[model samples]
Target: MNHGTEFSRRDFIKISSLFLAGSAALSTLPSGIVSGLGSNPMNGKGEKIVYSFCEHCFWRCGVAVHVSDGRVTKITGSEYHPLSNGKLCPRGTGGTGLLYDPDRLAHPLIRERKGGKQYYRKATWDEAITAVAGGLYKIHEQHGPSAIAMLHHGFGVSFFKKMFSEIGVNKIAKPSYDLCCGPARQATVLTYGYPSDTPEGFDIMNSKYMLFFGTHFGENMHNTAVQEISEGIRRGAKIVVFDPRFSTLAGKAEHWLPIKPATDIAMMQALMNVLISENLYDKEFVEQHTVGFAELWEEVKEMTPEKAATITDISADSIRTVAREFAFHAPAAFVHTGRRTNWYGDAMQRIRAIQILNALVGNFKMPGGVVAFEKYPLPQPPPAHEHPAYEKEVHSKYPFFPKDEPSNTIASHEIVQQAITGEVKALFIYGVNLPETMTLGRQTALEALQKVDFSVAVDVLPAEVTGYVDVVLPECTYLERYDDLDNGRAFRTPFVALRQPAVAPMFESKPGNEIARMITDKWGIHGVFAPTVEAGLDKKLKLAGSSLEEIKKRGVLVMPATDLYRKPGEPLNLNTPSGKVELASAQLKAGGFDAVPKYTKHPEAPAGYYRMLTGRKPMLTFGRTANNRFLGDLATAQENEVWVNTTVASKHQLSHGEYVHLKNQAGIVSEFPIKVKVTQRIRTDAVYMVHGFGHNAKELKWAYKRGASHNQLISKTDIDPAMGAVGFQNNFVTFVKEI
Candidate 1:
């Protein structure tokens, strides 16, 4: 264990010889070694192959796990997969280490008393189930089922929804909407009349021109998108990137327009003006497939490149050039829908504007451009049962729910505040880490936990949010669980895969679906939860017309081949009210937002302060994978690095790798180590940092003090007026030297 001890020459020779012998042995092993020990470097001996989906970030790429005697040896992308094409990102490969992590919760834990800081000894499954059910019954008896809120996170989500519905708790929330992808989905639905879940696939490989506005498909590793985009560029497609920082995608782009932060809407509007003024838009396609063009024309007529230059700080001439190129490119041009649109106020409107621009060029639903299609295949199941008694007890406050937001729409910050105010009596959180994900301060969520009567968190590791829970239940990683891959919508192919347990669950951990089933049985709501899961699975299988057991055995399934693009006169059903891609959305007007896509001035950063913009790092997947030793070791410091522009660094007299305190408008400051990325590629008025850092949890020993949290420097001052999405980028912060 002593790392510093020097080795003798003889000892060094012995070590080198052993290593060479091991390498030689590995070379002689079979390609698919079934054992842990083998000559092949890629394969191990006695390895049990299991199919599963990656949960590192939500691409849900199919993976194969190599398990040996109940231990997962390695994880690789399913070579037989039709979507990922046998490719796995670094985060997916590192997921194996998470299963055997020392910090993983081994058993259920409960607080000794209400509002207590310390937890009692680990309890048995029966005890944990009984306690949770008893607490819910108590809260129901006193207040009502409405007092109990179920906050679900991550995959296997439909299972939780069934449990909450059966248990008669009508209050439910998910972190996805307000914190991440909500704005994009909501905007797409409002404008087009259909949810963005069935996103229009971008034919990057076939396109001649691609425009990216803050959408980094390469770094985010959206399997199909990344592969296609890269191929398209190699085949001579021109890529233009518009962002405040030189993102990984921007670096590979043909042109990088490093505009000021939050100025994307202005740039897009300017492009629209150019297309209209020059008469370069697709006239035939627009007249046939769109409505409200006159209204859109009237609104955009005044917003010329010259007018937009004042707000966006881009040269008018450059905007005109890009616009003409994109419009004239016709069938070979596309505007990609970027992830993480829930970062600023009016983000929904911003996305609508971008999508409208794509439609103006007649790029919608065409090959070599943006095309609309259906992708996911459903799995098979059993039968349905009833829970009439429980159904009657459901809260009426959420009757409008699953109607407007079929998905959970409650914001994380608002849920925490309600818990603190005693509006919520009980909460069960699964998979997500609210302390790190929520825009509100960590202390605010912790205080909310203190006020709640009961809280249960099921996770792989004892995250910071676990400290605030009444019960902490350990859940198995993807490598040791059974999951269906049919849930994801394929952009490039029609395929379905199965995620079988590669190894038995480590310790007492269980799959999230199984856990939900157990809780359902305990609450005597078997009729509801049992039938729902069975019926849902059955519906999926019938859709595929395949046997569930056979699909499980094969580990992968593919639906009958269908046209990837929809044909004309196919009874196209647009989710928008007008039943077409709306150039001007009526829903926005009803919601008090601009009906026509219009650009607004970006919020100005205060003097002496920089607009602190946060995004993902290539190495890290939010805050979840930071605890993995293999991935953590790849970076020198296992935390976030604040990237300061050389201009700003010089102004502050700060050097690279120095510690600094990032102070926000609300006076909340986070002290973190900084790294100066001195490049003219980033805007001088902005500072950049990767999100999912700044761990305050004492239990995360490796991540505790590694980096500063960008979330800490973001105030809860701005929210998207239309959809209540958090304005994370609206924040302005000043960096002070840390003494």
Candidate 2:
């Protein structure tokens, strides 16, 4: 079967049976299964059981690692895991491949000389640590501590950020805020005074209506949301999807509105207009729980359904039908937050408009509706002793630093760019890959690295950003590390899970926390690393009012809470200046953005040009899983393909499965194997492709030279004025057949 094609129920069952049979066979084998049992050297059944979390992506699902004779035998999701529910995503299932990857950096390597292509031979941990610390100290003494910057990626990044601050480096950044979830978070903060966990828990099982605006939960593999969505469907929830493309989620939706791309806000405004004009909204909720209804009503009065129809390309009648359905559904309605919101200049506003729709339907904080509640509890450590040196230094450098700097630095992308231009230095990158994940003009980031006297990247894989680093530290994967699981913030069912090292570090790789301890020791700082991960668990236990040993033995912990809902006549205190869900934002006033969620015309493509959009496939995470042989083999190519509509393909005489060169407004062009998906399902003016292709790493033999980089075509745009996020979807490009 083609990898991209869907599997029927019968095929799915067959695949599941095969997987179960394999698991049963593996389980029945002796605990002493070793390398001699199979052709693969790493294939082994070891006696030691390592319980750890999968760090492949942020889902952080629990897994049991079977190690036989120091080799990982198999990886599977923990059936006992409450979050993952015994099913692992493709990335999680392929975790072992990463452990035994041939291309993995096994030891510390340093550049032979500045700007040199050749690297010196691998060195011992002691030698590497000494060189890295010494280099950073030397740079700090000469240029001040601000000469360095740090860009950390994945979870457990707090330890590194603390170390950098202790050493007096003020510059820090992560792609999380810029490339991924920044806009949604910013919008949440602006409206709620704090960032609400997105796709925020919906009582989907009981919901009667679910409206998705650009949310592709089914395909994104957010375990909880996907499970809930499926459950909701089983219960007969009306799922409506609004997007420009026929997304996987849209395929399942009862109504799929192929609106013009980047005009989601306009559609949302039109919905609001209909609800208000027809008096179909929750009047009681609006009158009692909200404060700015009058102001919002005045602002949206001009935006009639007919006016919005012209801007959004949806008929006014259709808008009224959906609006009436949502309002009539009452407490069982929700809107979901999807990934990749850093698309258009008004992305945050677009989300805000969608969120406002939920408020109009009286769904905010209600069961079977859009809800907000505290996460499950976990054992937390006692607060660390203050390192006055670090405290005083950080305050002096970053005067506006929030009390919780790591959690508060949502705008770090802009800060990192400023730091690169010598505005701030002293960078420490813990686990993120900035060069590949950030927006266009990566050369500027590279230049920023060059300008900084000290740069450090600690990652399991030696990524593109690591090549430009002054120090490249080998960090162990989650399988070899001890970390705490805090599900108390996102899930209503409070729980604490422990990640026990399934095996000892295979090479000289150290856990990030251990590395952090070394840095603190070198600087004469103390107490950051507990005697054991169990001791750290004791702290979280105190927070949860539970015993540490009990949590460890149970492997999982849950705190059940009552289903809470918003009280009657309570104010809908959305944190916007108006206190109501703002149809028009007062916050965007200074930024020169339209206060109303109005649709602006997308950049007109010259005669032959088309707008391009990017999406994800189930087999990959942004650039991370392309190296897995088992998963990679499931897809013929990892490159971004131009999914042209049938009309456009015929007009251009483009054939399916042909090679093409796609060029953008900035003159950057990428060549790729094109697969023209001709269907009325897509809009004629646009084309869709998958991201994380266009691998440039020669070291990744299988992935290199396969796909085209979406970044190449994204440079000719500006940041969203309201949120400072890169407008990745605003580019216009032309596709040419590769002769």
Candidate 3:
């Protein structure tokens, strides 16, 4: 097995330091590549262990950060954590790489004008906080608190949210829910009385049939879900996937319907119709636990398998057979209500249909069906400071906002649109890169930020987003600082996870709690902010029936499990109007929307162009991970590639592995040429590419212009009527042979 080479333990240790994780380094690189790897090692002195949780991805696996002297040397998943099960994903393993990235925002920076051009100058904590607070207070004093908008992404979001909420700056936005999971949340909450707080993980291991509609389960490896699915598949759960691209999950499935893009709704409708017509539904369960079934039946009776086949490009017989199989499995089968929902604007309706299907199968609270998880009670923040709250507006031309969950996440595009008109004066960006994640195009985002009178960004990394802001506040990486307590990483079992410092704050970077304290102190905000990060964590620890000492010792505190899954006699405690599953939502009827799912036509890609679809990879978390050296090295699309159908290549006189310049429908051309992956894996009508690549930030040397930036081409979007999520799928593109 040795390729004529051997290394001693000392040599391995010396070489391993080059890679982020020495434990994983041997597996990643091949033989003969090791030539003095660990050049600049972490200044580990006397080895000390610190308990922490990863902020790498949203999964937040509990970690054991080993330190020597005052520097973090290693990060390993806490063996005690049930979520990660002692294994770190690619992103989590590369936590140190992000911490050590050269392009990181090491200190506070204030934007200044030099020769009529905006430039950033380094500032101390006092200088940065005072200036930022001054700008915010000015905006508040001149206009209103509502004129100052706060936009955030990632962990410690609640701190920012509480500040804005208490301060009457009601224009706060958490783009994760608003942009990513809003549609799914709206549909699920409407149907079953609550959203899937477990995110996308269902009780798949309890299932005999697991169905997916354009959902990539294994591909986007949310650690716990990966284990759950692997166990489910092992137990003979029949996996069925429907996607335009033959994804990794699709490959593992017993059946993968290479579905026509934007036609999943039709197939879902057919499945429902077939289940009802064949009397495959659990009639007793429906009668006892559901409302408005008759109305649902009325809508879907005409949507037969034959009709669905015509719309979805799936055969009628196959659709009927799949439906029959799905229903026959009954309460043991689950139709996965996914996270990133459909792009057809009718995403809410489609998700409703999925939830309704699961309901019809009588699976709520069941072992293998839609199981609700538990959450521990934590200390609530002190009552939000009272304020003169102006009537929060929808703030967008594209309507279809959920009546209930309105005004929380003002759309990114809408913010930009308003900023362009000078309606928004002050914008605070926190931990998010708008140029990468937001829709309406990169230039548009830049312009919008430029138009704002004052803007600020807080992050560990310098980014294209930071370039547009008036100030940049460098926040320490997850490894270097403490934050508020994190809970419910494993939703089924209630647990409290803590983030503790593995090392002293490298450079002048500070944690979020410190940043909040300084800003509030400068602004003279009293009785509104936590005195220290430990105070907040202590409050949470006290509430969770655990102590800071226990957390420091074990990294996580897992609560004992209860008989949570629905047993025979339990009632389905639905929060809908009738306290039953709303087969036909009365709430929807109240809002003048559809009560039951309806087939809606999606616009086809015009003549020569293909609908450009963006999907996540296990190694990347949006564009945030693109700059990580370890991840970049392992990244398949570090120099991003488009997944075009083999036919697309021949038709356009293109070749596999050749470079192509893609010009999206809005006349936005790719910043760099991307490699063409001409394969039969994707549909001819559409092209696919992994997101978070093609980053244009000049400071991110490893990531810059390496791949095609999907956000750059994401110039068009369809807003979901119910959830107000920007549909990134309505975008189309045509490739140019010559740049």
Candidate 4:
């Protein structure tokens, strides 16, 4: 694929400076490139173009879809979009694969018993909408709206959220929170006074030094982040990575220290000790812009490098050397607060340690350091007539669980537990395949699904979740649908991008807006949505001082780059209770949690088992691309392989390319055999597997039984008491060789 223009070190520095300086205007595509491609039926080559954003992963990079004879031909990166920068990841370019998948749900279905066996029967849109609306309304009337909940993923969920909100059902949750972004988000809020955003609030392109703790950047393949990291490498930035496995990002690091798993907090404390004891940290910055240093030092004073070396299995001298080097790059260095950070139950404090490290180096808002980017300041149109006040949201037990996140009030695992307990009677599963998702595990997800009184699944594919739901609404793919305005992402150049259709909805599938509208209409609710999805989009755009017509041409409307660097001696006015960076969080302390990060040992693997760590392929997102044949065409993308360390493989008498069924600590065996990859890249104590595979859904022809299910092996999970994030790394698995 055409990844985009390769930048020289000088070119990268020049572009990065100009891009972040708030002076340079964003460049647009040449007018002729897409001239006469939209409205004209025949553009000489009988092709047309549509500007939309990708749905393959949450990065949401803008895409230029080329259509020929009423079908999508190809997808490329939109040069105008800030996130993509005219470059596309492997998944971004594979939209056609998902759009045209044969396993896609062609029509709405309702579960019906046939000959004493339950199975799905085809239903019309009206029938499906009526069933969903009636069930939800009945549940709301009988148990109040608190018993109705929605667990969703993807951009298409906005409309469904509106539908549920109108009836006062606010128990909405995204599995991404409990599983992926929650710990980092809440930790940053406590430490930096703002939640972290994608591209992760860093100036990667200009950084002179970068530190990562188990953050697999290159492997994660977030478009803008990867591009900036490449630029940073070209600019001769030094990198340090601390991970059990030698990940793709580690390969580029100046130092890749394979630290012991679950001992990251101890390593971080040791680094803090070095920075303080060696007088390498910036005292001026710390004094001027932070609070609670005394409390922080008190906690880390005894966590010397030698003591940490014993705990973390890294040499004391090496930890000191890394600390000094990190300090030497002051103001331009940052320890990356990683994504999917809920590794141990102490993830919140772990990230707090990382935040403190960044603060000690005085990197907050500095050039090439930790900087919060702004979102496009697009004004919202007034809500479509206010309804009665929503029920006082039922709060989760976790003290620091975020109540402000509109999309989620409770953790997903809580929702599952509530479902199984019969507290939540109705469920709306949008785009998320629960059995394959890491909420608790396959058994728990299935139990919840079976126990729920009514469950409706809105999805494009007939995923495993759909088979268990009472009703299935076939929502069209991103290529054929329009989601709400996507200005949620914060970036260097603030922008609002559009998700216009590239082709009409295929088969009996409808876009989410239409499905949501139909259901609300069945409930006798009106005016919640505009006359049409496009009309509502146009109205919202006009409110933002732009129109749909104008934005459709470029797919996005961008604001000038915000000035990211701090001026000399500028007073820091953060939003935290202290109005400054909190080295030791008073909020956490008040809540009876640790004021400063503390290290605690986690459970060790049993004699014949290893900790089962999970991640994703750069080309595949969990569940989303599991059945994308075009992406799966690559040998590496076909299935997930269990990466066993060379020594461990020998000990288990397993050879490379052999197949084995993973048996977890709970004695739950993988249904399918996974290929064994004997490599020295990973540590012996832990085995790694890419998540989002092992599809059992026969409807997913391309993905069925492709690999072992990582989620299924996770019989145990550690829940963060403060933030409610779920950590599944505690699960250990041993290999059972396939006959």
**C-alpha RMSD values across all candidates:** 9.0, 8.9, 8.8, 10.6
User: In terms of TM-score, how similar is model 4 to the real structure?
Assistant: 0.94
Model 3, span 524-635: residue lDDT tens:
7866665667776776687757778778887778777645577676787778788999999988887778888888888888899998887888778875688777676773
**Candidate 3 stretches greater than 4 Å from native:** 1-45, 395-409, 488-490, 635-637
TM per candidate:
0.88, 0.87, 0.92, 0.94
Identify the runs in model 2 with alpha carbons over 4 angstroms from their true place.
Answer: 1-50, 114-118, 168-170, 378-383, 387-405, 408-410, 542-548, 567-598, 636-639, 671-675
Most TM-score-accurate candidate: 4
Error of 1 at 398 (Å): 13
Please report, as a residue range, the 10-residue window in candidate 3 with the lowest summed lDDT: 7-16
User: Which model is ahead, 2 or 4, in terms of TM-score?
Assistant: 4
- What's the lDDT for residue 77 in model 3? 76
lDDT of each: 0.68, 0.65, 0.74, 0.85
Per-residue lDDT tens digits for candidate 1, residues 59-177, read 77778776664456667787767656688877777775466555667677755532422335567898888877777777777887767777766676666666776646656677666
Q: Candidate 3, TM-score vs. the true structure?
A: 0.92
Ranking by TM-score: 4, 3, 1, 2
> Candidate 2 residues 1-739, lDDT tens each?
1111111000100011211112332343334331212223344344555556677776677676767776676776777666676777777777765665555556776544334233445567777677667666666777766555666667777667666666656555566665567677666655544565643656777788988876777567776677778888898889888887888889888899888777776777777877888888888776655555666677677777788788777787778888888888866887766677777766676666766677788777786887765666443554575423223233333322233435434345555565556655445677666656655545555556565545567877656666666567878877777765555356656556777676677556788777877876766767666776667667667677776666555456766754657776666666567766554456555445555455566676667778888777776776567665546766533455678888988898887776778877766677454555666777888888777777665555556667676655666655666655666677777776653
Name the lDDT of candidate 4.
0.85
Quality of model 2 by C-alpha lDDT? 0.65
